[model samples]
Target: MSQPQPERGHMMPRRTFNRWVQNPVLEDYALRYAPKSFRRWSEWTVMNSALGGIAYMADFAIGGSVALTYGFANAITSILVVAAIIFLTGIPIAYYSAKYNIDMDLLTRGAGFGYYGSTLTSLVYASFTFIYFSLEGSVMAQALQEFFHIPLAIGYLICSLIVIPLVMFGMTALSKLQVITQPVWLVLMLGPFIAIAFKDPSAFSHWVQFGGASASGSHFSSLEFGLAAGVTLSLIAQIGEQVDYLRFMPNLSTQNRSKWWLAVMFAGPGWVILGAIKQLGGSLLASWIAPAMGSKAADEPIKMYTQAFHTVIGSGYAALALATFFVLLSQIKINVTNAYSGSLSWSNFFSRIFHSHPGRIVWLFLNVGIALGLMEAGVFGFLNTVLGFYSNLAVAWIGAVVSDLVINKGLLKISPSYIEFKRGHLYNFNPVGFGSMIIAAGVSIAAFFGAFGAVLQAYSPFLSIALAFVLAPVIALVTRGKYYIARENAFEKSDRHHEIHKHSELPNEIICASCEFEYEKVDMLYCPFHKAPICSLCCSLESQCHDMCKAEQSTH
Candidate 1:
């Protein structure tokens, strides 16, 4: 049953792409390795761009909404608890992605999920982008409605369309945009807090006791705390967007080790620290304005900050204008990232299923168009219901990935130490990670719908995390790690047992036989079907070959 070896001298016909796919600046290596040469930005610039997306106003709304529902003690306790978990889980994922220069989708492919297995996660990630895009866009529209007396429907279109040009250029434009606005953003973000603290120092004392609509009042309730935490846990997928930028980090070296680590830690998971603070601050402002603006109005950042600035600035019109300006700036900064990351996720998903890529630009419009529709449909009106339901799925996906990194690879040493993402090298399915996520998400979603009980329903997201974390390593052990790799890598044929880490030590450039383009050696795989070397992207887009390389290898 053994198959014949590939003909050594034969070459298959090559494939071609349009100008958009060929351009490095616009494409930004959407579905392949971000080679060392393309990662030309300094550590500081990359870190800033990665952190820019954290400026979203959704935190403000989420915090205010949760606090208004669950009271002060439960809301504050839940935010801190979820922030700690997010910070801890973010570290290893961020470190590995930066070290290997692969985006989250590629990392999922090699970490434990096999080639096609990660398509589900890609869809999950793409959903995160558009859902949050709609949420953030809704915040911007609310600001426009308040300031200009415009209809929410028209404002939605304006908010969604403005970021298209800014994000079309990919990292090249995003880097500059993030760096230029960061300083002003920091000042504007903190100004209201400082003014509120100095003007009415006693406001903090009153904030602790003001309960909007919670049955528990100022006291904590475990059930209410769990519900609040579930809403905040939906932010777990924000790390994927962080990894999209972290993949552009330059190779780690002794000279830049300290700077690199700092950037990764802060820009990666450290985002939650600021995010948690913004949430608590939003809670505080919501309390201050609830008496005047009513409970529902308190959740809107535009309304919350406008009243906060009234204490600092004398003119009512000036305060409204400043708050409007801040909201627009924050939304533009984050929506660009949302739109950009969504495009990358959709590209990863469809390119695998269809074996064709029109380019990242085509997906960008699709992602934005979906978000625009959601915004017009008023996605923000049902914020708590939407996010609580989504947290079950998001937490499960993250939990499975983290378990693979920290347990299977680092502890048990069952999975490959280095990432192996090339299509030719990976199997189509691996139950270790993908199966764990499906089981966990399914169980937790059932609990969310009260399959277990009221307490478990309130804490369904925790169940998802626990199940995924425990299941990944157990499944890997039971499967005997057979599904991790389909065949020994063929590119380093001098030693059939060579590890992929050695590929990074080899020469950088190799011209792919399928595309006739020079790609880094790490992204190129030996193709048995073509009897030549091929780049990962080119290999992914190949449909006629039917993965003949892995098929031939498995026969042995």
Candidate 2:
């Protein structure tokens, strides 16, 4: 754990941006890295919280939506292929953020997008949270309507507001909520499946026989498969939420070698393995119930779970109660994460644009408010269309980031091995990530809108992925990786370079002129504009200063 260094001199007291984000319990270092002291939880504890968000019943809803729109075979294959892509792409992102001890936003700032460029991706990521938040909240509202007869509109408000306090204290409260409820969620989730399997041995065969209404019965179309895959692919952004917890993992070492790898594997890319299973489960449950519940009801978690639970509990009211409880558990568990990650994304987005941050909590309400509006506007009804269009952008962003990590950083050496996320060291935009994302998303969205043809439209996700993968390196080579970095060795040139820590020695302190606050030696910088030391956070939010700190020629 790194200790805070107290300094001899302090500046005139003004509000510190860091102060807005410095809660030992609540803030969870939203604006900075998760140093060793704050990352005190065991690997398993973090893993549980990370996996808890997967409790969202939307996987079932999405799978069913895709299966209904397409067919069983295509839906299953799409879920599997998308899961493989998500898991593979997630590996480098999860590993980098965890090892570097930075959040997803900070990682984005370094991974070829630069400081402000990542702001666009921040909005993209924030949208993912709210869109999913509304979807999950709608499912919960349905549960409320089922068990309590709560109006859907009122239910939406109740669902949105319920998660606010749980997330205000950050991961401290969230981690516990997930851990405590996980056992019951698991049992309630599995009990119905087991009961159903034992009761009807031929049910699985029946599920395979049932094709969607629009389909040639029991046949698979390439179009159906592509649409199914595109819808499922929107979930690529789930890795960002996983990275939120992964960043808190204690630094890996030889002492905890096995545990470290286990944590990274399961909490990182391993999340998709479970996601795939849940999608399949949703598809099966929907396939069996679609005939009885109407096709639309198969798209609702409350309905699907209730039908399954009835098979187990054998009483209508009792089954409804149990299913509603499971839905609430799943929704609350995931909504908290949605709220938390949305807060972080909004913080990054507004702070960069506005040059100041009110705090992450402010954005929390804003995010929920937007999601609430969407729920009222019936975003859930258009789930397929919304997610299908949204996946083009989502895949574009993730594909760009992944391509940079695997191709540019690994093969081309067009980017750095280590992440340098500080604002002064990054350009406003890097063509490698920014350009590729736009081009990929543009093409995919065009196809999604039926610009190319029916076949290409269905395969829009693959087109987005392919273009992003190809363009990242091509742009890096064309630009010669110039915009990828602002100033070479800029951190070393800063006033308070990192000092080697020794057990017997006290660390140095430096004060920021703008905020007049003390920071550890490594956090301070010599601001060329202010002509005095400034901490990284202040330097980051300093708009008037521009890039004056690095406003010089670079022969390096």
Candidate 3:
């Protein structure tokens, strides 16, 4: 028995937007697999781009907010703990995603969650992009308000729209932007800290004891530490953004193994090392500037850096200019990543459900549009509440993915060693990842609302991690790893013909039956309906195919 072929006359022409959406730089394989030929960038270039998105100013605001709400001792302790966990969990996810040359959505799919099950995480990731974009844009608008007296409302529009052009072309545009600004961003970000230390020799000593409006500000409290960590933990999902570029990393090899590991470690989990420092800096700067700028204003990065620079520059106008410039540059650098990742997530989310992709660029505009709406609605004011609630979902999502990767796959060896993410060959849902995330998120979110107790509410994120870690393997064991892979790779013959695609295979191109264009075999699959090989892009857009090939296989 063999798979059936569709009647020749019934085959419909391939309807794909590849012409518009498949710009190597813009689409970057948002809706399909990133084959060997497309991943041509050097390790340094991809690493820099991943690292560039880490310049987001929200960390400053988050750092200051947590310290103000909780105390410096608690905030600092929680920050350290969260950073450690984020780094540890990020390593395997980053390594696997980079090695497979797939984005986070695809990684999640093969990490235990099935094709459609990954959509929940994709939406969660999409929401994160828009939420953080709005926050960073708000920070930029605050700078506009301070420097040009632009109304916050109008400035929000300008800040939100400005990054659209920069992000339109995807990694090609963003990588260059990140590299060019890397040096300047570093100077501005670090210059203020050095200037503050030199100008006020006692700044550190005083900051250590600053009360920050909270009675426990200068000292640690377990309750406050848990609470602070819960809010900061919302950022755990940021690894997905880093993965968006790291997926572009050139394949690891014996020659580049050291550099590959370095790039993955630094750009992946390593972003948090610098992020935590900026947070602490923000907390310290907030205290130093509070009396002059007012408590609420001190938490703003624009104000924190302005006061820090005022001492060194010795002029209010000059300091304001420097702060405004830094804010705009930092915001642009990060928002581009936010938008790019959002587009990828949205493309995955919609393409799966709707079975259509207008283009990754279309989703880019939609993502920015949603973020702009949230910004205009003053979502910035509820940052704490929003982040606290969001942490439950984010922690559960990341926790489940990490559990499957580290425990189910690594320790138990129940799931496949390699990611198997093609939709044509993956189950619609997998209980191992899906069920664990649901239980974890449900219980954690319930606790967050005080359904359990005040103590439970404070430690909801930890509970989510614990539950996810415990449940993932239990579920995998119970399910017998049946859903980890739907079937053997469709392209492989007898499991012996499986090919590990290499960049050197660029000249070995397959012709897309409908498009009449050549592409790497990695992106082409046999189309039984057309009785010829078709590119994945065309396979995706062929609404008329109706899984004829898979159905035919089932009957055999």
Q: How many residue-pair clashes does candidate 3 contain?
A: 2
Q: What TM-scores do the predictions have? A: 0.96, 0.93, 0.94
The full ranking of all candidates by TM-score, starting with the best, is 1, 3, 2
Candidate 2 residue-wise lDDT, 1-556, digit = tens? 2233334233444546445466657667676656555677888998899999889989989988877777777888899989999999999998887777678888888787888889989999999999999999999999999899999999999999999999999889989999999998999888888999998657689778768763656577778889888889999999999989988887666577699778878988899998888888888888888889889788899999898998897999888899999999999999999999999899888878888877888899999999999999999999888999899999999889998988898999988777767777788888889889999999999999899999999999889988998999999999988887677543354322212211113335556577765555445555656666667678778877668756753533
Residue lDDT tens for model 3, 5-81: 32444455545455657567777789666767677789999999999998989999999888777867888888999
Q: What is the C-alpha lDDT of each candidate?
A: 0.90, 0.83, 0.85
Local error of candidate 1 at residue 376 (angstroms): 1.0
lDDT tens digits, residue span 275-389, model 1: 9999999888888888888888889999988987888896899999999999999999999999999999999999999999999999999999999999998899899889999
Deviation from truth (RMSD, Å), model 3:
3.0
Worst 10 residues of 2 by lDDT: 495-504
Could you give me the TM-score of model 2 versus the true structure?
0.93
RMSD of 1: 3.3
